[model samples]
Target: MTLLWIITALWAVSFSLIGVYISGQVDDTIAVTTRMFLALLIFLPFWRPAPWRKSLRMMATGAVEIGLTYLFLYQSYHYLSVPELLLFTIFTPLYVSLFSDLLARRWPRQFWAPALLAVAGAAVIRWTDLSGDYWIGFAFIQAANACFAFGQVWYRQQSMGNPLPHRARFAWFFLGAFIIAGSAMLLTADWSKLPATPVQQGVLLWLGVVTSGLGYLGWSYGSTKVSAQQLAVMNNMLIPAGILVNVLFWGGHIEQWPRLLLGCACLAAALWLCRKRTPAPSRST
Candidate 1:
């Protein structure tokens, strides 16, 4: 927990920064690859080799989660409005729940309720009219969501069995991401669009070193501390938190107060459900 909540607050500001400073100003591939590269370097000093199997697993998770997820996510902004992008991400909580349950091979009835409620809460705040190309954007976001959900769940489960501390083993994860990200950058990047201004350079540096490096570390470690239900619901918390950040500092506006209030209430209830103890699903199921 606490790590998760803190990371949420940190990430809430990241979207706005990318939207204002990086998008269209920099090539997505370059920006992403640079972040992954810098993030990998941050953890290099603490890097320890896990068992071959565990190392490969973390690498795969990083490729799918950070590499593919960011690629699809950045592509999505091209096809979708900011509101549309936010709306599409409302499905992430559901994906997190589904993947967690399926991977565990058990029906955790208690987890589903809060996850669905969290979805509802997030959708309430972010839902808006779609543009004509929504299908493509939606598909990209869903792919990102699936990758992200599976990665976190896989990491959480594996963390339980791993002997090494989280910090010591995270370098492999970032290295995996860098491999994929760097390849994508090589293939798709526009050299002309690299950071030109001091502001842009500064933004990239902050995003790469702090946002991607420390942020992912906090999230990975924190995911292992919470139940799947809580983790699922927390995925949605970023929506409202991000919106609030945008409105307060970035000249964004809320379209509807009622929707915001209702959504907040639903999110509160979902969080309460996560905190409350419920009967576990029988093993026979």
Candidate 2:
């Protein structure tokens, strides 16, 4: 759990920093498009997955989870500060929980504590400082999280029978994502203005290959050994990790230490709840 926390925190910080860097270089659409395209290329040699037969449900999730999620997230970076963003980003667990219940035939109570902790932690982080602009981003983040939750459920369902090898499945997922994102770019982009600096190109490459590609690989590798509770705990750490990286490296706003401390406390409480042992369900007589 400790090692997972450290690795997941590092991944989150890398992702946050990449977001900051790319936001400055290219338009959000192009940034997402380019990243997906590059990620596709990187994954291609590894697995060479064929495109899956299109289902309306899968297509809908692809649009919401892959395309729209990135768009809104990129837009939020422009409108909201990092800590403010983190406040909303932390709600991922809540979205995951609610959606998980809706999808599962049985309403499992396993997620309640972690969900509460994540919400409370986020509140502690942003309660006093949150502004109207941040709320807009929060709403967008909620939508993104919902899409992500549903997408995960969909992937699990569809993949269970066909069972594309893990490497192949990832390759296919990125490829599918690129196709949608690329089409959107063709419809919306202004190609006349490409990123001008080497730094911008470098950032784009890192965002595509390292953050998007390698990050998922690292996560999968780490997740195999960690319990669900540990994974939940590791996720909450992304908020502080994002804050610290943004402030130290990218000159992000960091005015209130008390709020940050409170946020950490909230996150710690959430992880503690995860560590508690829930009794196994009893068999019916």
Candidate 3:
């Protein structure tokens, strides 16, 4: 399980590079479509869906929850630095916690203490040397997180007992992603100006196969094996992990050690909360 986390962190970093690599070749729509198409190719052979039997609700859910959200996020790479774009992701757990509270009809008393701590830590990160685009990118990142947080909750609620296995779920998601992202590409991307260099093509291929297909597969597999709260905690680490990787390989720079320390402290607190045992529901005496 720990190994899974390490693997995911490494992939998380690598995926950022893939995003930068493709920024020049394809528009967000095509890159997303290419990713989905590759993932679908890997999944479709494994899980065959009856052409007409796939439900409209399932299709729409996949499109909104996964496809469109990813489209916006991949586009963020073009407009924002890796570190700046990742900071926006700090809002995911906050939004998820809020949504969970609303849907459960009960606030998460356990989360509030650590949540505040996490926000304070993120604020520390912000105090470091700021870029002009950071503020603007923050807005887009928040929008992306809103979509992801809402979609994740809705998908989990609606699909908890869904008969489709993980592979099948991936298939459906990719199918819908292909439809939605393909349409967006047709409208937004200039097909004539596609990249011709081997390095560019290699990057796109890796993005599609490794990051889009295998990364999602690994994440879904790990999700099934872990609790949701644990997953949330692990997600927070993505920011630090992403930044560290970019700094080492892609010339990513951080101005202050305080930001790093604060972020790590916040992640530690979240993970601690996630690891706490929950009491079982009791019947009325």
Number of the top candidate by lDDT? 1
Ranking by lDDT: 1, 3, 2
How large is the C-alpha RMSD of every model relative to the true structure?
4.5, 4.9, 4.8
Residue 284 lDDT (model 3): 11
lDDT of 3 by residue, 123-150 (tens): 5666654556655555566677776666
Model 1 agreement with the true structure over 17-57: per-residue lDDT tens digits: 88778888889999899889888888899889778988999
Which residues of candidate 2, in runs, are more than 4 Å off? 1-7, 47-66, 107-132, 153-162, 220-229, 259-285
* Candidate maximizing TM-score: 1
Q: Write the per-residue lDDT of candidate 2 for residues 38-108, one digit (tens) a residue.
A: 87677677664344563344445445556666776777776567666765666555544444445554445
lDDT of each: 0.78, 0.62, 0.65
Question: Where in model 1 is the C-alpha error above 4 Å?
Answer: 107-129, 254-285
Better of 1 and 2 by lDDT: 1
Pairs clashing within candidate 2: none
Residue 235 C-alpha lDDT in model 1: 90
How well does each candidate superpose onto the true structure, as a TM-score?
A: 0.82, 0.74, 0.75
Query: Cα lDDT of model 3 overall?
Result: 0.65
**Residue 176 in candidate 2 has what lDDT?**
62
Name the candidate, 2 or 3, with the larger TM-score value.
3
